[model samples]
Target: MWAELKKGAAVAVWFMFLTLPIMVVKVNPIEQTVVWRWANLVWLGAAVFVLTVVGRYCSRHRTELSAFWPDAHPLLAHPQLKRFLLIVLALLATLFPLFFSSYQINIMTTALMYAVLGLGLNIVVGLAGLLDLGYVAFYAVGAYSYALLNYHFGLGFWAALPIGGLLAAIFGVLLGFPVLRLRGDYLAIVTLGFGEIIRLILENWNDFSFGPSGIAGIPRPGLFGLTLSVDDAIMYIYYLVLLLGLITIFVVNRLRDSRIGRAWIALREDEIACQAMGIDKTKTKLTAFALGASWAGMVGVLFAAKTTFVNPASFTFLESAIILSIVVLGGMGSTVGVVIGALVFILLPEYLRAFADYRMLLFGAIMVGVMVFRPQGIIGNPRRRSYPLPMAAADQEVGHE
Candidate 1:
């Protein structure tokens, strides 16, 4: 225990020392470039200290921490209560805009966007058991598809939405082809490289992509020649995202209950067994990638239309990381879990803007703590049944966690 505490403290110190400049420091050519602020150093020290203490404590009380939500466990197993809670949540979400201000509605819209992104990634990483680190590449593809189409061809948002998704689905196939046979870290590496490749291409190919300066004057979404005022526009985009999020949830649920979903689950659990059972691994993987990418593509259109701009910077590795984190944090295969995770992570930063500089620091701490104490995530996949075990085995599981 003493050795572990020392190691944890050393690791925390090393991380703060290394990433302080990169993550906590800021520089912008468009704004005040190369400006160094000393405030973050204090916050960094505090963050590191807190993380080290929490890490050491969690290491010791692993079992106690793992059983933190024992009361909620039985509730999760109850179908009627689960359905009731879901209905209440749906009602609250559907009527949110009416009770909130436009700004609040806009925030909810962003959360809903992340929810969709999280759901898409959940299908790939959660259900298919594939680790995709560069899923945002597909998001960039979708956004740029809409931007280029609307820019030169005079296409509307609705016209570009499906086209953009289709194009992204094609890209998904292309991405899967190169890394289809790879698994674990190898697949993650390729996907990460793929995302960087897409971003770099966009950054350099100024003629086609407009580079870092970005494409401006992109058209906002319109409904059949009905141009909404700014106030109405916020609500319009909010409802648009809300509708898409619902559709994504519904479709993914249907897919989860389908034969393909079962095949994907089998493949996830044991690829050798799945292949022996005559499951076509390649097609199953490609379909998973395509479906996930398609959702990202559709949401990409909504994003571009809402912002009315497109830039390579908008689709960075950080965006991909956050989306994937949401999926894993939310409990992968649980749609409700994804939504809750999205809202918590996305809005936590928003609400804690008073400590803006420490936002990422706090976020990182929360995620680390969760992983340390609750490895299965907040609302772990409901379908993954945990058979009651002997006390010895249960205690062992808790220790491992």
Candidate 2:
């Protein structure tokens, strides 16, 4: 009886949230830029409400529900049903832009960049167990690398993409060499200092970077000599980001399961044990740093094109922290979890227009809450094997390992 009530309530809540897209009103344009869709806010609210109700209901009638019927749970012991639900979700994500506006598509682009960045950071913090607080420095390097190279050399935006990644990888090696012996707080502090140092240089070095004023008019990405700026530019960027995001997910997943990836996990689990087992800690660590930085670099190129500008403000310690939080909150080492976390973090605040001023406050609170209640993060583990597995197991299996 209680299970049925829970199910009814859950369905009701889902309907309410799903209706938000058609109900919520937006008064301010700025608020709309980063806010979540009405439907998403509704869904989030419904999820929270249903969870609370289910908790109370289960606490009160735990035995009654368990005894009333062995098969009372509709979603239980039915793997196919779960798979079907997941396929629906994947379909929704792929088709979301088809139904959204240009403005919403732009926001989605930013979210995709965050997703890519989160994936990159996962290598350093999640896989290698390195606390890098200055990851944004590399992001800056990539953006500026592309910005300077494209503007000065008259290179194509497409060409600048990999060049930026290469530049970031070089700096990643330089940073790794010096900080190889540092760990924990010491490593974090150094990385933090590194970010500050880069920002200061960008601010003061007017001749090269044009100082705090920023470099403007960076080119947009193109395909076969055709720029994505015409027609639905946001959609074009979205597909580009999606393709890159998928590739990154695949690469990370493969690496995590491969020999080098195993070495990274061993190092993350125990440096001493890794050393004893003859894993080249130094080389493995550097590879993680380089790969992590390379992703940031690639995203930087995308960002520069997206914004058509590059400045120190774009790559600050806060940006690094937010990216790191996505990795941590999504469940480090879990690609799907990180991607989901990125979506929520990027989209939730955009939808909360009434509480616009409290965006950062809520962000901090959510991070703290997740850390306290779900240390393994919302997805629940670094490895996908451990879970609160999604209702649709087969659909959930679509991404990287």
Q: In candidate 2, what are the lDDT values of residues 1-401, reduced to their tens digit?
A: 67756665776677676666554644456665534456656566667666677766775776687554332235633899878977897687689789988788888889989999999999998888898989999999989988899878988778888999999999899989999998778999998898899889999999988999899988778777764544466687788888899899999999999999999988997899899999998999999999999999999988998888888888888898899888888887778878988998888877767776776676687778777545567564445344444764766457423
For residues 126-146, what per-residue lDDT tens digits would candidate 1 score against the true structure? 899989999999888889998
What is the TM-score (0 to 1) of candidate 2? 0.75
Candidate 2: lDDT of 141? 92
Q: Could you report the Cα RMSD, in angstroms, for every candidate shown?
A: 4.8, 10.8
Count of clashes in candidate 1: 0
TM-score of each: 0.84, 0.75
**How big is the positional error of residue 121 in model 2, measured in Å on the Cα after superposition?**
0.3
The local lDDT score (0 to 100) that residue 114 gets in candidate 1 is: 95
**Top candidate when judged by lDDT against the true structure:** 1
All candidates' lDDT scores?
A: 0.86, 0.82
Q: Would you list the clashing residue pairs of candidate 2?
A: 17-42, 17-43, 21-39, 34-350, 35-350, 35-351, 36-350, 36-351, 82-391, 82-392
